[model samples]
Target chain A: MVDRPGGNPRAAVVGTGLIGGSVLLRLHRRGLDVTGWDPDTATRAEGRARGIPFPDELADAVRDRDVVFLCGPLSSLPETLLTVAKHTGPDCVLTDVGSTKGGIAGFAAAHGLSDRFVPGHPMAGAERAGLTAAVPDLFDGAAWVLCPAATGIERFRTLAALVIDVFGARVVPMAPDAHDAAAALASHIPHLLAGSLAGAVADADLRDAVLGLAAGSFRDGTRVAGTPAVRTADMLLNNRDQVLAQLGRVTGLLDRLAAALRAGDAVALVGHYQRARELRLALLDRELPPVVRDFPLGGDSDDELAYLLSLGAAGGHLTGCRVAAGTVTYTGHLSTAPA
Target chain B: MVDRPGGNPRAAVVGTGLIGGSVLLRLHRRGLDVTGWDPDTATRAEGRARGIPFPDELADAVRDRDVVFLCGPLSSLPETLLTVAKHTGPDCVLTDVGSTKGGIAGFAAAHGLSDRFVPGHPMAGAERAGLTAAVPDLFDGAAWVLCPAATGIERFRTLAALVIDVFGARVVPMAPDAHDAAAALASHIPHLLAGSLAGAVADADLRDAVLGLAAGSFRDGTRVAGTPAVRTADMLLNNRDQVLAQLGRVTGLLDRLAAALRAGDAVALVGHYQRARELRLALLDRELPPVVRDFPLGGDSDDELAYLLSLGAAGGHLTGCRVAAGTVTYTGHLSTAPA
Candidate 1:
């Protein structure tokens, strides 16, 4: 293990399954002071077996920690985040690795912990579950989204620097609601479509006949449908509000295309397809924009938080941070003309 | 060129685009007498430049041919097939490489040419268009569906034999309607879903923000959305009847899942996803059944045609054919138990 420069935040992870275990591994490798605690005894034992400290009581683990990462399952996250938040030492910051942010973020706001709490989602995973699948490099070069609030700006900066410098991830700051909306657009809705496609093919008259006709389109479209039904169900239900809205938009498009095909209106059909083709091309040919900008840290103002949030909403990504020197650097994301 | 033995049907390809040119190359490589023709002068020139015999007139090119493949665009297939059928030598068989079978099959039934016209769709192609992308092995290991009518049984066997022996393709014999229905389920509807996925993501409020969240599911689901709008529109429109019916089924599934999510009906959601997952596993784990059955050729009876159609409907595949010795050998396709 290699020791890092000054001001390495002492960290505590409340869950030691995939994401949390991965955080523990990465932190330990950096020679930083990190502790892990899992509510499940078996999981806690597994973390201890890996030569990391795992205190029996969550309170004991989180005491004197500078930041506590709530990496529990979504079903258990509400209680878990609040419990950890309530127990953390004064001035300690809190963040999470949950998929949907609204639930836990709301709990934070309702309990008046917004100033010391930030919610995050790291876009990385292995196909397998639990600490067995965890690795130190899991977050390297991955996108770690942090929804920063004005009240939480200082802690947000501290947490953001830890994510970028220690975990080797780029942070994308979004408001909790916007993050859920974008997740719906990019991940959740496509999965629903995949399930629908797979189900339709399976329910066809003869499975063999359809399988014989299956090609790249069928394979690619249905690929995600095989994701664990439990996880998939949770993902959709957890963010149903945004998913429902996006689902409506997608079904509207499907209805229009179906109508055009039924009408045998070739002009309408081609024009409708043209729009999708143009967008696909624009996305494929887009290069990452290269304008890097810096925001002064420790400002502790609403403007600073809003600026960071706006940059992420505009798709800018945090490239690096110097917590000791107090600056966060980011670059604008896409360089494509809108379709 | 290696000469193929007995009854090598003298072949003429009437539209030297990718599929037609590929057929020409495959035939010529097998030392079959082949002539290529295209209405476009440049395409014809490209064909001749590739050392194919591109006779100036379509009638002259197809004269004395034992079989004529109408390989034109979907819009012109009807006229081109009829025109070639009008000029070909007596007893000449006709087939096509069009994606849709209904329009041309209906025209053949109307024109009293069903006895010799066998509509086919070869499941193969290059990404690029025209003779430039043509290759002798384009049909290698591909499924060539011959929608055999009882009246066209003899000609169907001959074409099936040619497809198997010369082009190295497996002939799947189907009734025209079944072929269209299978195509709709496997190809057409999946394409529409892909386009809808792509268009929805493109039309999201912030493209870069959405794109950032786009991962394997979005990419795979939208992979075929980039298929040229003209071709995709034509495919959906040509098979609109089956495509529309399948669309309703898919949208129905989507709506059910959406409602379940809306009502927090986890049971319905998980059960729905379970069905698709089971089907996917069945397909992936299925081993090809190895019972080869022999059908005596030259029967020319309705019994022979019905047997072939039933095999295809059950998804059995033609493994080999002996045109002169008079038999077709096929093996059952999927050993997968019903999902």
Candidate 2:
């Protein structure tokens, strides 16, 4: 793998789902020789239809590939890694995009494949899933965590960095346990909270009223609850200890707020909220670059011009100007900085 | 008050904050004879600067108004409503925009003012607060809940409906107790959850790491945590019983999920998440109409025209046409519908 320093390396991705297919597409777009293998016929056909090269046999896809990516669901990662280990060439660098890193690292260590494996998790996903949900920019600007095992080879890092660069992701390295713990607090717990909040409404007799009255706060707070259940369960079980610990911390906070409410101790309740508000503000201060998207204008009438101006001023950073071919384009930042 | 059927009514808004100033601005936009009063000197100054008529004495603002809106914080609403009852004429309609309706209704009933009061909770807010944060379109397309007291007069309903219509809000009527309960699950509990999630990060030694990796899910999930602490505390304490009840339900769901994780029972965990996901999707499926806004273009250059087209094509329903003053304006819907 080290011999291909300035050249596009051969890559194979197992499981052509959202994460995997996205990696394949992004790598392909970046001019890599990529191949894919998935168990499902429909997924494989879909990948092929999207111009992704699919090898009929798993071993054929894995063999001689400089890098092998196990981008399957958490439940299937261990088996997929084993298949990669058995089929990949001696110099191949193994990586994965599973939500949890600890379990995958442990499996690789136990199988004596630790040196060749780099357990990575992309902190980016959509509520949608599968091949159709795959996008080339899915991992752009996302944090891509690489928890390299103690015995992992440097080549694995190099290969992983190259793939991450293709996806335009920022690489973050941490110990496997630390990665799991941080993820539990930042991602897993939020999902649990979203689901639990939604569940509370589901169990309420006034479900219709509650849903109707739900505003931006409720909608945003429960957005993750719409994610696929099996995927969430897989991540939760894979990172059980850390998820449980974070859940305990959150529950304790909830209890304190509840107590303050019961005692009519507005000062104490305000203190808790103030601290949380400060923390949220601090988190928001970490800024990212603006998101810009382009559009084409079709008409040149007064109504068309009014419509364009309306679109530009529609509660965001949209601005526009005319271009060639009677086209008008606009650039705007999509994300709103916290107030 | 009933003498003005289609005519603009005389209205007064107490507490010149975001909600209050917005009401004043929108009502003024609708050609109402509006006046405002606030205990805070700075807020009152800001409102006056925005062209809102203000009286130095609270009673003076309330005296001749056909409707008096107590738009203060939850803690201040009782006193404000008492002031309105003391000065307003017999036919005047009374209302308040407190998050929790039951407390306000109880206070009104105790003061023999229940018949004139229609407690409301607007399902709209911003992270920003105060007079500068007020916008004429703040309540547009938002749900304006009217938890009218049992003894509330018909005039109150009529006046509230007119105000709601002016704000372009959809009016939803419910019993005070029912409104409180529903709001606990839909709004208050969600805020508590957001705060708790942020609080968990605050307590962690890896706070920076967690925050850095916090993606769309965490950001959206914790957005309400950025809201002012005193306001949240007031709302929580005002609806203590319902808030506690909803918290209890959320905790129960969390406990079940934790138990399933501990047992490594994927089936049980999946069931909990599946039910939640279904509930969330159902809630989201209750669609609302799109929100449209307009922007005015400055120049007629090809580059400017291109910009307009690009703006129109950016991930929304954007369209534009030429208008007076060489303006090429565009119209775009602001919010995305559920996928």
Best candidate per DockQ, number? 1
Instruction: Provide the global lDDT of candidate 1 against the true structure.
Output: 0.79
TM-score quality measure for candidate 1: 0.83
lDDT of 1 by residue, A8-40 (tens): 778899888888899999999999899999888
The docking quality of candidate 2, as DockQ, is 0.28
lDDT string for model 1 (B1-339, tens) is 012344566889998777888888889899988899999999888878877789889999998888888887788888887789789755888899888788889999999999889999987753346777788898887778998787867777678877888888867888888888887877788789988877877677866777665556676777778777887888787898988877777888988889999999989999988887776666556565656566676554676677778777876667565543556555435344653
lDDT of candidates 1 onward, in order: 0.79, 0.74
Q: DockQ of all candidates, in order?
A: 0.50, 0.28
- Model 1 misplaced stretches (Cα beyond 4 Å): A1-72, A83-95, A112-117, A122-144, A154-171, A301-304, A316-324, B1-69, B86-93, B123-143, B158-171, B204-208, B300-304, B322-324
TM-score of each: 0.83, 0.81
Q: What is the lDDT of residue B96 in candidate 1?
A: 93
Clashes of 1: 0
- i-RMS, each model, one decimal: 1.8, 8.9
- The digit string of per-residue lDDT tens for model 2 on B13-95 reads 99878888888888888888999999988877877887877878898888888888889888777877877788988789888
